[model samples]
Structure formats: structure tokens, C-alpha cells
Target: MKALAWLALAGLSCMAAADGQTQFAQKANATDVERYEYATNLDIARVIHTENIPDDICEVVPIHIFYEDSHGERHTLEYSVMGGHF
Candidate 1:
């Protein structure tokens, strides 16, 4: 019972979507993020940056996503390497 509780607690630490994969929340939206899973023309790299601004202004630190992608191909995205940040 205690082991099961531990597992449940660990799972709660991550947010899961319909795909049942754990993902971190990004400050940017879909438009800001570029997805490239299987591409032949682009080698993209992203970095997630966070900063606290002065005067009560919070800076949006974007997430950094890095992966490879091909041209003119339908690529499925996953939690590990899917979208780009910043």
C-alpha cells in the first residue's frame, strides 16, 4: 500500500494529458513554438528561459526544444522532443 501511494505521488508531480505523458508547462503558445520531428531541411534547437522582472513585471521564459525534422513530412510530436521554446 505504501509503495502504491509513492507511485501515485510521483505521478502527480507531472502533468499528463490525453496521451498520458508527463509534460512541463510552457509560457509560450502553439504559435510561438515550432514543431519539427522529422525534417530534412532544419536542425532546430530551443531553450527554456525564466526571469523575474523588476517592478512586479514577470518575464516569460520560453522553453527550449531541440530535435531534427525533415521536409514535407507528417511528424508526430511527443513530450520528449516535439516543440521549440523561446
Candidate 2:
């Protein structure tokens, strides 16, 4: 019983840490997409998620990247990319 309790506690702690790491700031809005700029200082520690670019189109499209910085703060970056179907 003691072992099981310890396992449960460990599991909960892991879940909480995972949850906290994924909490990205709500900076991107419909009108305010966080576009990337040249020479922008990005302190990315790990990329959490990336929006898939459509392969069938051949034009500029917006892509979103969700990442965590070195300070453990989550951020979203939106940038334009030329589509791959060109």
C-alpha cells in the first residue's frame, strides 16, 4: 500500500510538470498573429508543437510554432512560408 501511494504521488507530480510546461501564452489573436522578424532573438529550449503546412498549395501560408524558452515560459510564433507544392 505504501508503494502504491508513492507511485501515485510521483505520477501526479509528473503530470503537473508536464501540464505547466505546455501552458503557452495567449499572444496570437486573429488580428495579432505573432509573426517572426529577421534576427529576432528566440530563446527556444524545445519545440512543443508545430502547425502543419499544407502541401497541395503553392503560395505563402502562415505556420504556427509552439515552443518553450530557456526560462520555461511557453510562447507561440507565427510565420509565413512559401508552400511546398511550388
Candidate 3:
């Protein structure tokens, strides 16, 4: 009975840690998206870079995008896009 209780507690702790990490990642992704969006003025953008992150843990994706403003100046920005099953 005591061993079973200990095992249950351990499992719960692990779950809590996983949840915390997921939340942290989500907040970080949101902040990055907002920051990038605010700092750029682009008429059209295209993905210049991509990296495959682990899908099991989080849904945030890293991408480098390029765009041109009205003045014909090109800008490259890094953004974290949160996408997955809702």
C-alpha cells in the first residue's frame, strides 16, 4: 500500500512538470508572435527558413520569413507559429 501511494505521487509530479513545460512553451510562442508582428510592416511574406520541432511536446514552429515594404526594403523576421489540432 505504501509503495503504491509513492508510485502514484511520483506519477502525478511527472505530469505536473510536463504541464508546466507545455504552458511555458505556449507563452513563449505567443510573445514571439506578437513581437514579430509588431516590429514588421510587410505587404507579402514568404518562408525563408524552417525547423521541425518535436510535435509530441509542443506545437510551436520556428520559421524565418522575408517580406518587402512599400519602400521596396526587404525584411527578414523570425516568428514562432502556434498551430495544431484545436
> How do the candidates rank by lDDT, highest first?
2, 3, 1
TM-score of 2: 0.61
Q: By the TM-score metric, which is better: model 1 or model 3?
A: 3
Alpha-carbon deviation at 11 in model 3, angstroms:
42
Which candidate, 1 or 2, would have the higher lDDT against the true structure? 2
- Candidate 2 scores a C-alpha RMSD against the true structure in Å of 13.8
Q: Candidate 2, clashing residue pairs?
A: none
Worst 10 residues of 3 by lDDT: 45-54
| Residue 35, candidate 3: C-alpha displacement in angstroms | 6.2
Give lDDT tens digits, candidate 3, residues 1-86: 44323322433343423454444433434334323444344343322222333345446665433333466554444555555434
> Which digits, one per residue and each the tens of the lDDT, describe model 1 over residues 1-86?
44323322433443223321112223335554553233323322321221111233244322233222344222222222212232
lDDT of 3 at 27: 44
lDDT of each residue in 1-86, candidate 2, tens digit only: 44323322433343322443444423345554456765556666766655556799999887766666799876677766678797
In lDDT terms, how accurate is model 2? Answer: 0.58
Candidate 2 wrong stretches, greater than 4 Å: 1-33
Order of all candidates by TM-score, from best down to worst?
A: 2, 3, 1
Q: Which ranges in model 3 have alpha carbons more than 4 Å from their true place?
A: 1-57, 83-86
